[model samples]
Target: MHTTPHPPTITTVAVPPGSAIASALPGAYFADSYETTDPDPATSALQAWLSTVAQVPGWTNRLMALRNRLVRLAGLKDLGALGGDAAHPLRDAASYRVGDRVGIFRIRHLADDEVVMGQDDRHLDVQVSLTKRQPPEGPPRVALSTVVHVHNTLGRVYMALVVPFHRRIVRTLLARYAAR
Candidate 1:
C-alpha cells in the first residue's frame, strides 16, 4: 500500500492547452484539472485511482451505495457487468477504445499518454481525461481533468448536488496516487 508523510496537494488548474478534451465540447459548465507527481503511465495511474475509488469502504461506501441506488432509480445506467472477457480490474490499454464502456462512461479516445472518457444523457454531457507528462528535471506528472456541459434544468441541479462530493473524491483519489 502507498503512504505519504502528508496528504498530497490537489490544485485546480485550467485544462492544458491543446488537450483533446478542450475541443470535445463547447461551453463546459464545469471544468477542472488536478495533477500530482507520479512516475506511472497515465493508464496505470488512472487504473489505480479507479480501483481506489470503486472499492469505497465504510461511511463513504454507504454514501456511494445510496447514491448509486438513487442514480439507478432515476434510470441512469449502472456500470453493468464487466464480462469475463473484459479486462480484470480495468487497467488494460487494449480493452479501451471508442465506444467501450468503463463504468458509467464510454471511452472516447485513448493514446499512450492520455485516455478520454465521456457520457451523455438527456440532462448533461461529461468528459474526463487523464494524461501523463514527463518533464526534463522532475518526475513524470499525471493529471485528471473533467468537463461537464449541462443540457437542461435537471442537469444544472444534478451538478449542484454533485460538485461538493466530486471535489473531495477527486482530490482524495489523486492524493492516493501521489502517495504510491
Candidate 2:
C-alpha cells in the first residue's frame, strides 16, 4: 500500500522579548510569530521564503488581490510588485541601507541573523522581523514576527480586518519553509 508523508509542523511562537522589531513600537497592539526548523542562514532562508510567498497562487492570490484593491481604495499603500528583474522580492541585506524601500515596507534594521522592516501610514506603524536562532538541539530555528501599533480608531479597525489573514499567511509560509 502507498502512503503519503505527513507534512512538517509549524508552530506559533511568542515574539522574542528583546527583538529590535519589538522595540520599534512600544505596546504593540498586535504581535505574533511563526517558526520552523531551517538550517539555512536566516537572511537567505527568509529571502527565499519571501520570493516564494510573493508568487502565491490559487485562493491565496485571490485574497491578496482583494486586499490590494481594498487597501488601494482606502488610500493605503499596497506592497508593490516583487521579484521581477530583482534577485528577490524584498530587498536583500547587502543591497538595502536604512530607509531603503522594499515593497510597501522600509528597511529599518539589518543583521546577519535578523532583518527588521517597517511601514508607517496615517493609521498605524507596522514592523516585521525575521530572526534565526540556534537552539541546543535539532536544526536551527527561523521565526517571522510582526508588531503593530495603532494610532487611532482607524488603525484598530484596519488591524482587526487584517490580523486573521496575516496569521494564516505566516503559518502557511512557515509550513512551506519546513517542507523545504
lDDT of 1 by residue, 1-180 (tens): 988577666667777667788786478898888887764554553464454445443555455557667778777644432221143345454556678777556778676667688878888889988776776787777777899999888889889998988777667767766766
- Model 2 RMSD in angstroms: 3.1
Top candidate when judged by lDDT against the true structure = 2
Off by over 4 Å in 2: 1-3, 42-55, 81-93
Clash totals, every prediction? 0, 0
Q: List lDDT for all candidates, in order.
A: 0.68, 0.70
Q: Determine which window of 10 residues in candidate 1 has minimal summed lDDT.
A: 80-89
Candidate 1 versus truth, CA RMSD in Å, comes to 4.2
